[model samples]
Target: MNPSHRLSTFNITTLALGLAFLYLPIVILVIYSFNASRLVTVWGGWSLRWYFEFFNDQAMLDAAWMSLRVAVTSASLATLLGTLAALALSRGADFTGRTLFSGMLYAPLVMPEVITGLSLLLLFVALGAGRGFWTVTIAHTTLTMCFVAVVVQSRLTSLDPTLEEAAMDLGCNPARAFAAVTLPLILPSIAAGWMLAFTLSLDDLVIASFTTGPGSATLPIRIYSEVRLGVKPEINAICTLVIALIAAVIIVASLAAKLSDARGESGAPL
Candidate 1:
């Protein structure tokens, strides 16, 4: 075969192997979620007992609800704040300390979670604020906002500024110009950022553990505590359900993106 063909074959092989390496554990976990055996490795028979047990467990259900609420609230707030920050950073003229401001915005993205948690805990204590759902929400928003800002900045970088200018030329006010011209173009990025923030908030354990108070346990905290005792099939089942839900969200988002692209190409309004 030609050298180019051989290289293509090698690339394909590498990609397949990489995907398998990443997904193999997920496949195992999904399969074992239905296993009847108490031991994770030994599959005595195919059964849905674990799923039933997971559904019937009130603590798990409460934790799941708490996680959902926190993720939704934090992601929404983060998206709003990050979108504004991205617009200001991307569109505003250069000013003093711009670089420092940008660095501060991204600081939490690279900072260790332990340090962030510790700092926030101390700040709360110093301010006489008690840990609870609001504290956890604030912690999650701070971390998730960095991801939102990055995603929004990337989208804004590629956008044409002429649309906003044209809208302004047509007598549209600044806010109206953004709503009519800028917002539509950058909506995909905002949506992606929101999803990233949601996922990050959902998966967070360290910060949640530090900020959450009694009766405010999130799903990750509950799962981590349970795993310390020992692994259970119910944990596997819960994970399987979460994985399935995330998969569904991704698929739906992909389809929606394709539709949006098709509409844009057809000169239809979003």
Candidate 2:
């Protein structure tokens, strides 16, 4: 084969291998979620019994609900704060401590989850605050907001400042110009960030484990506890549902992004 063809073949093989390495275990788990046997390792037959049991388990259902609530609230809060931070970093005039501020904003992105969780736990303990639903939500917000900030800041860096300037020159105030022009363009990034934060919050285990209090166990925590005893088909069923939910969120985010792009192309109003 020619060099170009050889390179293309190598790339295809690498991609296939990488995808298989990442998803093969997940595929196996999903397939086994329908197993009729109670033994996780033994394949008796295919059935939906585990899924039925998963739904009827009140503790799992409650944990799942708690996780959803925390994820949604934390993601929304993080998106708002992160967007503001992005705007300040990208659009605001230089001020004293701007460099320090930027570093602090992005610090959590590189910080270990264990360290972050421990710090939060200590702070809560020092303040004599109870660790529960809101504490978990706050912890998730702290971890995820940095991710949102990174996403929004990248979009802001590539944005056309001239559009907002032109809007301002045409008698719109800065906030009005941003509302009418800049916000529309950066919305897709904000939405992507929100979805990312939501996923991270939902999938988090270590941080939640450290910060979560009694009676506030998340799905992951509950699953972990269950798995410690033994992996079961029901755990697989719950995991499959979690995977499906994340996949659905990703699909919705993609469609929303495409729609935003189409609107921009069609010159739709903000």
Candidate 3:
């Protein structure tokens, strides 16, 4: 074989192995979610008993509901604020402290979650604020916004500046021009950012634990507590359900994006 062909084969083999390494644990968890045996190691038989048990566990259900609420609310707020920040940062002329501002925006992305959580907790206590749903929401939004901003900024970077200029030349006001011209182009990035924020918020556990109040415990926190007591098949079932839901959302989003792309290329004006 040629050297290039050998290199291609090596790259493909590396990619497949990397994917398997990342996904093997998830595959095991999904398979064991349906296991009838309480002991995770011993797969007695295929059964849906764990799912039934998860449904019957009211506290776990309540925690899941709380987590869903927090995740949706926080992610939405984060996406909105992050989009605005991205637009400003992307469009604005270079100014004093611009570097500092950018660094601050991205700091949470690299900061240790434990440190962030503890710092927020301390700040809240210092300000006489209580730990609850709102606290968790704020913390989630702070971290999630960084991700959304990064995604949006990347999309904005790829956008043609001439689109905005053309809209302005067509007698549309600045606000109207952006609403008509720029918004459509960057919408996919905004949506992708929102989805990422949602996933991150839903998966967060360390920060939520430090910020949550008595009644504001999220699903992950509940699962962590339960696992500490004893590993339950119901936990596995809940995780599997969450994984399925996220997967479905991603697939639907992908299909919708593809459809939109096809429509855009069909000669109909966007």
Question: For every model shown, what is its TM-score relative to the native structure?
Answer: 0.94, 0.95, 0.94
Give a tens-digit lDDT track for model 3, residues 32-149.
9999999988998999999999999999999999999999999999999999889878998486787888899999999999999999999888998888989999999998999999
- lDDT accuracy of residue 67 in candidate 2: 99
Model 1 TM-score (2 dp): 0.94
Where model 1 places Cα greater than 4 Å from the true spot, the runs are 1-9, 268-270
Please say which candidate is ahead in TM-score: 2 or 3.
2
Ranking of candidates on lDDT, top first: 2, 1, 3
Error of 1 at 51 (Å): 0.8
Backbone clashes in model 1, listed as residue pairs: none
Candidate 3 accuracy as lDDT:
0.92
What Cα-based lDDT does every candidate model obtain?
Answer: 0.93, 0.93, 0.92
Q: What's the true lDDT of residue 83 in model 2?
A: 96
